[model samples]
Target chain A: MNDHSTPILASQGTPCLLVDEERMERNIARLRDRLRAAEVAFRPHLKTAKSWEVSRLLMTTPQGPATVSTLREAEELAAHGVKDITYAVGISPDKLTRVQKLRAGGIALTILLDSVEQALAVAKASDPKDPIPVLIELDCDGHRSGVKPQDATLLAAIAQALAPRARLEGVLTHAGESYEARGSEALSAAAEQERAAAVMAAETLRAKGWPCPVVSVGSTPTAFSAQSYAGVTEVRAGVFVFFDLVQAGIGICTQDDIALSVLTTVIGHQREKGWTIVDAGWTALSCDRGTATQNVDQGYGLVCDLEGRPITNLIVTIVNQEHGIVAARQGTPRSDQEFPIGTRLRILPSHACATATQHDRYHVIGAGQSDVTAVWPRFTGW
Target chain B: MNDHSTPILASQGTPCLLVDEERMERNIARLRDRLRAAEVAFRPHLKTAKSWEVSRLLMTTPQGPATVSTLREAEELAAHGVKDITYAVGISPDKLTRVQKLRAGGIALTILLDSVEQALAVAKASDPKDPIPVLIELDCDGHRSGVKPQDATLLAAIAQALAPRARLEGVLTHAGESYEARGSEALSAAAEQERAAAVMAAETLRAKGWPCPVVSVGSTPTAFSAQSYAGVTEVRAGVFVFFDLVQAGIGICTQDDIALSVLTTVIGHQREKGWTIVDAGWTALSCDRGTATQNVDQGYGLVCDLEGRPITNLIVTIVNQEHGIVAARQGTPRSDQEFPIGTRLRILPSHACATATQHDRYHVIGAGQSDVTAVWPRFTGW
Candidate 1:
């Protein structure tokens, strides 16, 4: 970042993707070791850390398993020689072809579907050569997907209908709402609630004589705080790979633990409007509109310097598709002084998963944030 | 979309890119004919229309000309036989390797650089065998890149510095701020302002004895407007190919003209919270903060039916990386009567480019909305 002769490509360009490689390596090691100590299989969600370079670290571990929200990630990760992947999104009758194509190519693929209708559709359409193995989703957080744990009859119906043709591998749940917690204290409690609910559904399925191997409970907040695994066999969490402002706001992870950021340049100052325009717009930093009532209302994200510290109360308050408005952190934006145009800065994403998808590569930054060690290119596609 | 069992390999998933083949064809035809009538070269910006399929259409217009924002696009377009490309993004010294690689790969590439330091960097790093040509970017609206027109002395100095080792081709300016205008009237004024600024810059550069060939002024909103194209040689607007909510919000395009939207599902509901959860989250819709202001706060996007019609004012209100919250359009979300889970809905993207990055394919919905036509796939890479 010093007398690098030209603008540090790392310090220049707007709409840039920055990864704290050191922090990422630590997160990877922690997750791998924690699961090993607990004697449970670990599958890091590739959706958060989209970079194959970061994801490659997992292959060195025992259960180099991974999870994805789209078929694109499956194809990309598969090409990278990291095979074990679970397409975590609910399966529709249509995506079965993409799923089949992945499985046919020799990638161990697992999918999730909740309703009996969807399961039946997938089972009916699945090829005879490679039938689909599905994890019946269970709703623990009351946030999304999965039937209620109390609806044992409905759960049995879905499993029964899907079991004949499709393999009912396990039950999966995500306490996504755990991200709404105020602190580790609340997050720990949310974790317990997530575990208990998922376990209850697993027990209900067990009582009905179903083979639910993967009693999954996932969410960055819950995954970090859950003291008990109980009936869970596998977990499916995504955001832990690159904790964001939202996660830190909820106390799931500290600001120091956050790893991903959007690199931007100070473009111009609208002194009249009191707005600081940066090159990183909604296009570079994603539009994860998660300004919870409690969390810091970072317009889009917190603007930080190269050392990774917030620049005053400055937060990107408004953003167009390719334009962002940075304002004073304390009050309204004051475009009084001019930072040299093209000054490099980083904007931490509100949600890691959303921001990671926008960029195809990551200029991995490391070496105590002073000097970048290497530029590792990652893949994103189906 | 239909009961067609062919697995059209598309027509499913939220945050999906829909190709308004008709509107696109029209937009393309109109731009070509209008530019021809104006007697100005039309070097369409590929940044807005990133599809090779779309680029090919522009190249086929006999102009055989185009502009690119990323080296990846230039390489891809070159592979597709598109030799003439202007790399619009301001390059840092580090990108010298990429520029060299592209030049050797046989791409007729011209890049943009503003200062003498960059010109010197390029001259020093570039292979003597493949000296680069540069477009001295001009600041038209004081939006993003380029030297100020009034600073003719500085422009001449940089141009002369790069002239020995590099060909100073022309001046290009993107009236990106045109999108900030509300209607055609505002766009017209912005267009005139942009044209006047570009002309003045060219006049100043010419007076300094620099033969700038490409005098350009463009933004999709002003592409069709702006009567005075004096001294302007070409247009470099991009977003006209794939219109979105931002365009519609600016009254440049109608909602019916929007070609892309994500098809989602009503996953669950929080009755007490007055919200309905949709499968389309920020990952699909993109966290593109907003445009102009937070006024059109389509959290993730506007939820519409499969056929494409807004559902109440119930903006996607809030979104997580992969989860969207839909509420009552008129008032608060009233999930009193349980919305039978597993309902399919479409959420129009706030910006087509950002949202399209999250997906792998475009499910071309037929005119009837739900009828499946053909599937168009896109490739993303550096």
Candidate 2:
């Protein structure tokens, strides 16, 4: 942002991703400290900050105890020397070869499943000497894919199907519904429900004589608001690595805690309408309107100065593929002189996970420093 | 899809992009024939399918007379032997160096701008011996950036500012508002308005002694619905290469005309809730709900079979980071046996440009063939 030999954002070009390392480290520490106090293992989901530099910082060790949404992330992390990972998404038969390859490459990778069909597929794919680790996903508040926590019959059947061929690691449940919970009490209740559901499912598997060792429960909101981890062994949460407007809207993190933003340059303006057009549209900031249903809708994103300070009442109201129209939140006409052409601005995203996927690298602005000190690369795809 | 020894899709992986070559070629022909009959030169926008293979098919020749939204696209096209390109987005001062570099590399990359500020920047950056070509943008409808078509004073000022230093190529206008025009009559009216605005701006510059030779006007909706391209010299439209649900909803194309889709594999199901979860979520399919306001709100996207046939009333109702919940439009409970785990499916996108941005490569199915014949790589970022 300031002079070294050159201006940081100016040299990098507009409409690019920026990571405030200071804020990101703080976010990482906050979660680490919280989980440590709760006595639960913290396996940060690497889907948000897909960069190896960021992943290395988030993991408990260089060998990891990390969570990934895809096998691609697991492979990339493994290349960076991360040995332990959990592919948290429910397993499908097609991805097992990649899982087997990762395991063959000396990485301890685990897969998740809910149905007996998936259990049998994992069993078929596993080698008896190095049986693939499996987790039975439990439904926490019925938000998404998972076997209902009370479905003891399905749990026992899946566990029995994995016997001798695949190691039944434990049960994992995500408090995805926790994202919709409002206020502290509601968030706390959602967290408790997630914790209880995972414990109950693990107990269900254990009652049937399966060694269900892990009880995993998480979602950014629940991870921060949970009253207790109780019987949970580990927690997995993404988005928190780069808390976004959606998180701020959900009371999971404050606006100042957000570490990621899209740097842009104002290119044109419609004076009468008070709309300042910037070069960072959906292609740069992503088309996630996650805050639209929140108590206060942050349309597209909140506009900020080059220093990443939010401009009061300013947000991106509309976006084309390569252009964003920024206007006052109240729709009041603003003088074109305020955001003249070539003025540099940054936009905080509506959803970090969605927005981060738009770019392949992050220009890291060092902690308390203006200059960009590092560039961390990221990857996408299965 | 059936002939390959190793099953094309089975080997590639799920949540990948698929381009039906037959459908895409038809889409391209439909637009080309329409613009040709209208007597306007087609300069297809390459922002939707940012692949060299697709660009080669869209361009008039390998040395193209093409349109691009970003300089990155321009450079990529140039690398693929495309010589003539119009960077359709409003240019900023920071990008001037790149424009100079592209020109130095023997690529004729023209830039767009609308104000005296931008004109001065261009003139300053331009070498008098090899002047930078500039196009003054005119606002067809109060949709996005550009100077008002009737703003004669500003138009004259910008033209004067570019005199002798920069080449004022002509005027360009995009009927972005056409995306909201519901009926055929409304779309045709929007096209007329766009042509009128561009022609008016070109005439305005010409009256002031500027040689405004080119008058470019287009938008996907207007490009196909235009009853007349009377004063427009060239037509520029993206997304027509792979018409999406939004285009179909607008009555510009039918659902069968959509050529892009996300291939996914069902991973889990909630039978009682009627949810069949797949591995393609917002990350793979994009979070563009462009059809939400249409007559038929195609929730995330219209669910399709592996062969590209839309399953009756089925759509991706909800999406997480790496999970999409497919369900019937009527919300009736479905049996888990209907979409058993591991079942392969394809989902048509709500917006092709947004959806295409999520992946790096397109697995192309040859014309009238089920087998994936090629993998065209794509690049992203500024």
Candidate 3:
């Protein structure tokens, strides 16, 4: 009744996060099927989609193998019956207590460590209790973290220092540079780099008398590119659930794979200047300038109609706390490209993780208005 | 013992949101002091802090004036005994049901409208119900919404047509462009523009025989700059409760006025590259590219030590979902800059409102760490 009679448009709303439940299920099912075809164990990171509801949907088994950033996530998922968890952060000194508590909870906690200092902290903490099993993080192509795979002596030193007190489980590496890849070839090359790094680190740990059972390597882009897990024990990825503009830009997924989006209402229009303001600002769609530095900077996010097609040369130029100015990307502002007042639009998030943090709940929609499956509430507490 | 002996840090752990209760008290006192000095009615916007506890502090009386962005905020504040409320959004047809319900609940509700079509919609909706008082949002700057002051006749016509079914309350405006102010002069200019536009609009409305009562003009930056509210009846400002880096960058408030910050721990260090990665990423601090184009672009936010002094030439660059990399802004990499594992650091928010939406609760810290008052939860459903 409010002017937007489009068959695909939902009722006008602002500051709302929408999860196309059908698309989300398809995205998850596709990835799980792919990992099944590759015969690789998929331990999806809970950090991307923090919802237990989404996590429950993605998993096929009762004891879901998961990847986590904080002890909070591990504890939350662990409490929800998600066992076989990998706390995929370099364990800090202060968090030892929480880590110990998590370990004592009969949760299979696998903490990642890079240096001897952290190894000492975890080793001593585990000795008084039980062996805190840990995976030695190896530096891949991206020089973010990890003991360099070639630095096998340092790995042996760390393993020697902690092996008696803590269990040296395996080696893991993330092909983060694959996010920077433009196509499948670059993603494949990045995957190769990741595999080689983890394999080399595991071999070094094994030769040096450290048990390296798990060799984990995965990124969404690389999961498909190099599926032959030669030395890899498991593949971990989180973004495969809700593909973003970044994932689509990397050619890892299509636009249809982007299951989540921000549902916004067009507030007003500056017809002369060729800009329309929406109620969903950075508070709804996060200010992640993801893929902004890429060849084509998807400013803020990709603007789509209810049907979800990219409106090229259109950019969310400016954003206040609760207002986004959707304007022409660069040149002359066209007057014809105007959505009247109170029009509903959906914006594709640059990164699913950043955008998901903005809203507290997601409205799971089937196809149109009559197909609203349910309203799933997601918890966001640090 | 933790490597870093910062006992004052978060026990649940580092890299979370901290709310200084004392600072919050002082901030509220300052706003009250400012209102007393200016002799103007103050309506604190709940969109800034979004905390019921903070709202209770602001409410000197049960019938305190407040502005909210969502229906949830209005209903919550109403339940908390706040009577005079302004639903500060371009009202949509779908939310009119809630508005009617709110009006029926005996809470004084004022809505914002711009164009004639919207005015007509509101007029038609309030048929069985009494005419609702409406505030015409005046466009002081070409920032977001509202009609310009010069277009007063069109505004008068719209007011006249809707006056039969809706009460034209008065003129109201927000100088959102004040955030872009370089100094006090620019801020004052923006404030003057805001005041003048609303005053002119009020004059135009009054000249046409409308009994306009409230002439409201506000915005955090403008409220800081403008004085002598000759025609203005009330001022609304949020974000002053927790001043952020954007507020500091504009030369409005000092770093000390900032009451909220993200508590982050040094998780990993690339010592060779001189980069220290923190656990708080775009998810914690918000991804606002705040005022970056204007002279000084804060990459994510200003990185500060525990005491809140800027780490000169160091900025957080390339943020993923839950990872923020701190690197030297200018000089070559230095070894001393690389923090050891588990070093706790406070991160300044670019925009307090945007940053606040990331967290569910604020860990209220008192005079010091030993006096941890309590955790204040916020409402985030819409």
Candidate whose lDDT is highest? 2
Compare the candidates by DockQ and give the number of the best one: 2
Query: Tens digits of per-residue lDDT for model 1 on A345-373?
Result: 78888778767777777877765675555
Residue lDDT tens for model 2, A211-290: 89988888899999899888899999989999999999989899999999998998998877878999999999888999
**Model 3, span A289-356: residue lDDT tens:** 77776766677787877655667667677776667888766563553676776777778888888888
Q: DockQ-based ranking, best first? A: 2, 3, 1
lDDT of 1 at B61: 51
Candidate 3 chain B lowest-lDDT run of ten: B1-10
Return the candidate ranking by lDDT, descending: 2, 3, 1
User: Model 1 Cα displacement at B374 (Å)?
Assistant: 7.1
Model 3 alpha-carbon drift over 4 Å, by segment: A1-9, A127-129, A309-315, A331-338, A367-370, B1-10, B127-129, B307-313, B331-338
**Which stretches of model 2 miss by more than 4 angstroms?**
A1-6, A331-337, B1-6, B330-337
In model 3, pairs of residues that clash are B15-B263, B15-B264, B292-B297
**Residue lDDT tens for model 2, B1-382:** 2232236664568889999999999999988887777677999999998999998888877898899999999988888888999999999988999999999999988899988999998999899989999999989898888889999999999988887889999999999989899898999999899989998888888887888989998899999888887778999998999999999999999999999999899998887887899999999988999998888889889998777889888889898899999988754444344877777888999999999999999999875435789899986887
Q: Each model's TM-score, in the order given? A: 0.79, 0.97, 0.94
